[model samples]
Target: MTAARLISVNVGQPRDVELNGEIKQTAIFKDPVPGRVKVVDHHVDGDRQADQVNHAGVHKAVYAYAREDLDFWAAELGREIEDGFVGENLTITGYDVSHAVVGERWRVGGVEFEVAQPRIPCWKLGVRAGDKSMTRRFELALRPGAYLRVVAEGEVGAGDTVEVLSRPEHGFTVADASRIFHRDRAEAARLLAVDELAPPLKQWARKRLGLELEEEGG
Candidate 1:
């Protein structure tokens, strides 16, 4: 298969916006950067997450969404969607982000990244789309994109070739993660097999398997 390519590098800062008649601060409004940008351990150099408590972390330092998915949405919504419209840090082409497996390592430009988990839609996404049901729709569509952890800090820019260096044997993919998060709560073993998954996802799996209370008590 041909190498996947980074279509755009996007960055944004937190800003206040009115959503559902309430003032809210969000960093979902991103614009493509013109040149190479630094990829750090915690986040991209020019990007910031408004909700540090839930959004920004080592496990979710960067978000990648497929350009094809954006095109799909554009057709579905009957409107043009730009590269960073979905709040992705990296807009990628030639690969299915939803099929990315946890622990899969990708080398892009000079940086290396690991697939950490699938994104879980929040109210902010719905607000950004100007529809309260957008979150539910995103969850149901099961194409919520993938979050990545920076394994090696380096500079990256648009048109960088993405090389897959490794993939885990567990076979747990981002689509499977989304299924476990949304519909299939019985796949605890599959969820646990992805050892590199974020702690929150692991906890969700434990809860689905009725092990959270037991583990907590012990």
Candidate 2:
């Protein structure tokens, strides 16, 4: 297993939304993008269940750990190979994570979330990406990224070495789901059934799979 090098960490305000109804544009954390993690208090009103706080999808910040770090902990992170997910709030890169099929798990710092599904490209990332196409690029990548539901919630910080305890299921992975979820409605429905996905992703999976929506591949 090759480790992904930590590229850059960044964080920013909604640049559009208000915090707790207060009109604040900046976050408490500087260097918003941590070398390995990014903690923020943002908003996700555009997601499926935007009204719910947990469904906000932008709280608790996002930790963008490098995939390269996985190589070191495969042995020590004693958990089911499929049960690996360090506290990396978001596991991705210019890479794919949506296709990580059902039953596969990622354990990090005692935190675990199965490879549930891909994140729908939302306005939040669009702002973060700085390019309107950033979301488009994520969608095009198909493996938009990995969504994790906190299994054993614990305080995680940057510089943490997240571990990928298990390889993806056969013929299914985060990458595969990305392509299928957006392009093929049938497959999207399938992922929606997985229990590990966050609420927002679950809603997306159900809607896309239920409606069998058609998407024009970019």
- Count backbone clashes in candidate 2: 26
TM-score of each: 0.94, 0.52
Q: Write the per-residue lDDT of candidate 1 for residues 1-218, one digit (tens) a residue.
A: 66789989999999999876889999999999988999986798899999997898999999999999999888877899999987999999999988998889999999999999999998888777887888898889989789999999999999999888999888788888898889987776677777898888888778778776755654
lDDT of 2 by residue, 1-218 (tens): 44432233333232334434555332212132333332223321111232234323432223333343332234433422111123233433322344455445555443444454445554443343334454565566453445544444443333344566666435455555566656775666655555544455456666665554544571
The best candidate by lDDT is: 1
Measure candidate 2: CA RMSD.
Answer: 10.8
- Full-model lDDT for every candidate: 0.89, 0.41
**Candidate 1 displacement at residue 126 in angstroms:** 1.4
